[model samples]
Target: MKDLLNRRRLWVGGKGGVGKTSIAAALAVLAARRGKRVLVASTDPAHSLGDVFASELDDTPRRLLPGLDAMEIDPEREVEAHLSRVTAQMRRYAAPAMMDELERQMRLSRQSPGTQEAALLERLSRLMVDDDLPYDLVLFDTAPTGHTLRLLSLPEAMAAWTDGLLAHSRKSERLGKVLAHLTPGSRRDLASPFEEEGGDANHDPRTRDIAETLLARRRLFHQARRRIQDPEHNGFLFVLTPERLPILETARAVSSLEDAAIPVAATLVNRVLPEEADGAFLASRRAQEQSYLSRIDETFAHLPRPRVPWLPTDIQGVDALERLASCLEQAGL
Candidate 1:
């Protein structure tokens, strides 16, 4: 359980409306208060960290506690930014005649199903590899289980896609090279993106922009996947309550992560009933929860299961978070 305090990265996720945000916030508060520089970020499109912290938050990291910062990763903004970058990159190679079609294609890509997730994955990869990042620990408040599973599976899929493109490009280049011996201007030299832009566009007619872009992206996804699978540095923490649906969903999610070789650190069972509660109605709910708690123990017997007592009021602001943090610390996590 103490391993939670030292991980370089922790991704908190589970079924929606499970109070995962609050749990993530509490962990951040605990870590930051103990002198660890922490960044608690929300990757879900519906922003609620601001509400939990009782402070306004945006894309930028805003200082919360002395050692803690918070931000919301906006998928919409990332998608638009990704589109703009690609548009600009394509503009460098596109001829005047193709500009209208290029614009139409880019516009249509905005409404595509996987565009949002792809854009978000790029942002996440950048964050994961950022050399200038200052936080000792980063906690990601992720979306619901299904969306998160898809997001986690993307790096491999994208890398494979890039590999196919590279293979096709190589085949085309070989053919082009063979034709170049028989005809003038039949092939171009591949230019590295790091090289300074200068001279005529025809300087190296073989400038393989497709090859360079695809290769670079493949490396990025590969690096992202490596870090994501490292158990020593990363933890995939699932937050759930003592209930039937969350338990079943978590079981499936854990199995999926195991299949993907992602680390499942532990489960934080929030809103466990307290012993001091009175009344038959409350007792009945507690009895049912007891059975579910037993089920949770049996299900996740291999991992640490920390139970957090239910609060009379909703957890909010630094004060409420501090209280929750204390409970979390006492839970030995």
Candidate 2:
């Protein structure tokens, strides 16, 4: 588990409400305590990073300790910002008559099903490729298993989509060249809505501009995927409780991540009943948990499994987080 600390990025994900946030926070605190500069950012729309750190945090990182910072991404805001960027770019080249129609379509897109995810992917890609990122490690406290899998897969999906656009762009360029060769200087009649008033119809600049834009975005997604899967620079840590559902969910999540080529480095088996707790009910609970624990070990036989004993109190602020971090250290995470 300690090997994960050497990587530049870590993604902590699991079924929701399984102490996922606490586990992520603990790991971040643990790394920070070791003098590594760390940024713990939440990708969950319903964020608990503020509660875990006992500090208010938004999209921008806020200092939580000497070597640690925390942030919670606002998905809605990212979506709005993303659409605005695309709209601005279109307005720069689109015909004036198309502006109203474009704005109307943009408004409709705000309600589109995948717009939020696409926007979040764009934001995440920027974070991944930013050369000015200051942290030694950036830990993503991700949404639950299902959402995380989709998010990780986006770099590939968007890249493919960009490739398709580029293919079309190339095809259009070929068609234009063929038309120009056949008609000579008579190509002005072929001008469409894309041409500016004074633009040369012999050579439409829109296709070239669109191709350049798509290529730049393609590079962004490519770099993001490259960083995400590079074993030496990244690792994905999964946190799960010793329960049937979380165990099964984790297995599926790990499988999806493996299919996507993201490095699944380790697993943290959180909230194992402590030996000191004594009662008939507690014993029965521990007995059930023992079976699950055995199942987890067997199912995820290849992963480095660390067991964190359940804590008696809530983990908030630096002191409580330190206790959890110590538990992580003792558990060999």
Candidate 3:
């Protein structure tokens, strides 16, 4: 098979309780079988990748199927790592006790939703830059509507924040140096602790560099968002069940993505009733499905539509998932 996956990332998201994860996993499996290295990642805090794959996955990618790997990230872990880096930078000139107290306070501040998401994005950027485990395709199994929107909008939000932060950082660095040189006790008071600890206190160039890198990371968010909207590279798939509420939710999601100018490549209507009209129960279910499927067509006329019929057995193991993949492929996904 030839390579079919694009280097651009795929973002799978939709209303809460939608089978977004299942569809994302199927897409990754299909792409992998098509001879592309793929990573299907669960970016949602309440992740279910392990459950879907019937195996545990760490922050690092673990091979699940042929040519496909999976990773489940907990933003809390990323937040803790970010906090450590921040404290290390501050400890260059701060006293040990003072640094500890500052770190404690900063940890409290990171409890905010915005800070947690930023930390996760920073970690994700690092993974993207890593050369060792580069994959042809990346699928992000995102959180529900509200959280997913915040994650998607991080690019614009972080861009604006980065501009202001860069300016402020530069101004503060200059002010700090001037204050240290001009004021008698200012240099000694701040520099003494680091000097005693054998730490370089010449305003610590590393800290400045890290601040610049963090600002650059904010730019990476914008780049990632652009990659998502780029038709040749990224594919955004919104998954929904065949029901009135999920159908309505999918419509809202498509509108939101369009409003943000994010390109949506496809939609997956998951767990639909099989197209069999034999029994009364089955026939009634199929009728209901046809009704919503028509509704889906009207809403998602721009992209390809994929459907997953309800199977007798649960989709858990690789064998079952492969069956699911076959069904998706047959649907022209």
Among these predicted structures, which one has the highest lDDT?
A: 1
Runs in model 2 deviating more than 4 A are 170-203
Collision pairs in model 3 = none
Off by over 4 Å in 1: 171-207
lDDT tens string, model 1, 23-93? 99999999998999999999998879999999999999999999999999999899889889889988887
lDDT for each of the candidates? 0.87, 0.87, 0.76
Instruction: State how far residue 87 of model 2 sits from its true place (Å).
Output: 1.2
Candidate 3 global lDDT: 0.76
Q: TM-score of every model?
A: 0.90, 0.91, 0.84
Q: Candidate 3: lDDT of 86?
A: 74
Model 2: worst 10 consecutive residues (lDDT sum): 193-202
- Full ranking by lDDT: 1, 2, 3
TM-score of 3: 0.84
